[model samples]
Target chain A: MAKREYSYYPGCSSQKGASSSNMMKSVATMCEELDVQLNEIPDWNCCSASIGYGSGGELPRLVMSARNIALSEEHNPDQDIVATCAACWLSTREAAERFEDDENMFKEANEALAEAGMKLTNKTPIRHMAEVLIEDIGYEEIGKGVKKPLEGVKIAGYVGCQTNRPFGIDGESYENPMYLDGLVDALGGDSIPTYEKKVQCCGGALAFSEPEKSQEMIKGIIEAAYDNDADMIATPCPLCQANVEIYQDQINAKYGTKFDMPVVYYSQLISVAYGRNANDAALNGQIIKARKLEEIAAK
Target chain B: MSTNTAMVEKYRNNFLKEVEANVEEGEWVKMCMQCGVCAGSCPLGNAWEHPPQEIFMMIRAGKREDVLTSDSMWMCTSCYNCIVRCPRELPITHIMHGLAHYAKRLGIQPKGNPTQWFSEVFWNNMMKKGRVNELKLGLSMYFKDGFVSGIKESLKNAKLGMNMQKTKRMAPMEFFGGHGVKNPGDLQKIIKKAQELEAARIEEHGK
Candidate 1:
């Protein structure tokens, strides 16, 4: 079989965080075995997520993400730039859309990029890892690769707001999104239907800008997951993971619910189900401890 | 017509003007028909003196001070529900934020009791660590806001939190301490940058 190689952009969160970084490494290793090469983009910059755009305007953040996309395009003209971070994926996708739709903005942004020795073009498609894994690479292929199936372990897939919101992307929908569910099924687990708040914000910048309100919002999601009997929660965004995991205790306190639901990067869960080392997947000491997960997986 | 126009003109203020100037994209406020969809959809609307629709109406009528000083300005959850649902596509939530900033300048107190307290603790944590320490901030907020019940409940979850911390899944409280700063100088720079951004925005809007 021919190797499927993609230019990967790990973004800032993956570079600093443990679960995201570890999972990306595992995904890369898995991809290599599956004849898929994930080449990391060189000298990538920040995606300038919610904070960057919310503090300033979209132009600055868009241009920054555009510069990174432009770099990826220069390296590979045909293959999509696969982004692991949901925020990075959203920003890069929005930037590409804007570059193609808004001529004046594109021209000005490209001019700004020229000073930094970058060019902006609307050619390269931004694919979230979830999409690339499920859509381009078949689930049966992944099922064949799974050394250990996560049988009897129930996972609540939290898609986060950015990955599937504001709709209109090809093969992506706000309602009835199936990419994550398919991935979970391939790894030998049951993916439960998430609550209405599944697509809600993980209270990203709001965590700093408005703590109490953010806490309430985070509590709402965790409570919903607990109410649904999910053993663990998986998401693609590192900031979402950080916010949701860090605040799990506070949510438990506020709602008086004992939710020991471990928040893992979806890739990490995939790694675990594939019989990769659970610790290697960085599953222990998760914000919501996964001791229960370890126990369940053992049985 | 003359009487009604005069009455409308009497309520004019800078809050609406500032909102108009700060809105970068999407439908402007002129499209608001007072449908009350924003207010109705708001999770915190009942708690506010003026719901989101009322705020939009007040702003449209140029009642800037009324909108800015209204306790409802602080009641916004910033959920972006109004922004997401507005038929006019007005950035209603963001306008509320801009009004909050303006309200601070006007020396108006936030309507809800917890708004100022939460804001201070949150920003202080951010200024000190360049990130939020949820435990420290939560405790500070518990005392400052008198949410003792919340704190007592938090203690039970503290055991779970500690376990997470041990695994390094959660950030340690000490992470907020070092933050790569030897002195308060770094903190000062962050505050200065914020002040500069606010000043630049004010200048652009002539507020």
Candidate 2:
């Protein structure tokens, strides 16, 4: 039996063939090594992400998360709901918080849920995968599994936007979240302490809509990592991973600079350090390959 | 009177009150003391015609049409920098979204706003299947401007797309109606009912 189990909510980006499916693969591999089992909530729909606020409105947005929560409660009763996606976790957690604080909103949400023959009792706790990794599976335990430590790999942990602000991981500063750095250290990699742009926004869903502005923002993040002499950037959010990694070509084209920064999930680092092969860690999925991590994993 | 005009008359031209009643965390807008912290904190502060601080003041000053029609609110990426640094504990991010949402509902949001267009496309894509078909969403965004520009965008991204396909990160098969929920119809009914309930609530507020 696994030491801990969670009802997982893999957001749209983590779906097979989606943008950050590599993130899903690495998280699964990491979880397996850590003895954590993540069971997907059956028939779970989209959490509407943050962009949904424009079209979803207040009640509909709440109801979207409510439906997912209701489903998670029914299928995986008594287990806490966990999401790897920062936006999904934030939306669902915010909904849970709203259901607790506002009676009328809760009643309205239940009414909407009634339309689908589901009801939200708001019994289960919503959590990010990082919280489980840090709080539940502590650094010492995780360190124990590191058969091939990421030696000499200087990582700048980029806790961008959603995961670092408003409702960040417990006991972590919004401006400078140290949990990612700690994870890097646990994997025997050098964590750059002066990574100033860690919490900066990667333009979120607006990256595609407004590429220039978003790329300018992405430039600042990549430059900060380079300034610190980092090997790669690790992040907790899939959108952050996608935005920071996939746009280097455009950024280089527009700005007349060479930037080939490897932005990856922290879970990938963990899996690689745990002696998992490159395929197991899904390193090939990277738009900007982390050659150093891949070399380490191959060994 | 048009609903927008009637809304103005109903609130007696008090945009802040109208916002508080209709917007999602709009009551918190009154809490802004014009410290300009939010304006300074915004990542895209220079890009906005009116940052959060100015937008808040506009609401207080009853610049209803200007506040509603301005494209500033749509620039928000919900990075939550303002919310975290806000001394008043105001939910500035939600309020910004609420303002955009309110403007869109009143049918007065700025035209040709890319964010607004993408938001609509995303919402519709997710609503149809209860899961977002990312391929369709990406194609829709590229083609939104026109056929010629869409071709340019597709060709530009062709290498990236091929790389993604090679890595198995993106499946071309997804273009033909990818994964969906067990009961997309039921999910649609839930959203429809929720929307109706939201409409009724807004109507109650209007009264």
Scored on chain A only, each candidate's TM-score is 0.89, 0.99
The Cα error of candidate 1 at residue B30, in Å, is: 4.0
Q: List candidate 1 stretches off by more than 4 Å.
A: A17-26, A29-34, A168-176, A194-196, A292-299, B1-22, B26-59, B64-165, B168-207
Model 1 agreement with the true structure over A97-194: per-residue lDDT tens digits: 86787786677666666654557667887888877777777788888888778877777788776666543235755554666677788888888865
The runs of at least 3 residues in candidate 2 whose Cα sits more than 4 Å from the true structure, single-residue gaps closed, are none
Each candidate's lDDT (Cα)?
A: 0.62, 0.91
- Interface RMSD to the true structure, each candidate: 7.1, 0.8
Query: Could you give me the TM-score of model 2 versus the true structure?
Result: 0.99
* Tens digits of per-residue lDDT for model 1, B1-207: 332233234424544555665434323666777888888766556667888777777777767557656767566544455665777777676566555655555345454545644555554554453333445654565455357776774674577556545755345544455222233343334234434444454454442
Question: Top model by lDDT, which number?
Answer: 2
State model 2's lDDT. 0.91
Q: For each candidate, what TM-score against the reference?
A: 0.70, 0.99
**On a 0 to 100 scale, what is the lDDT of residue A257 in model 1?**
72
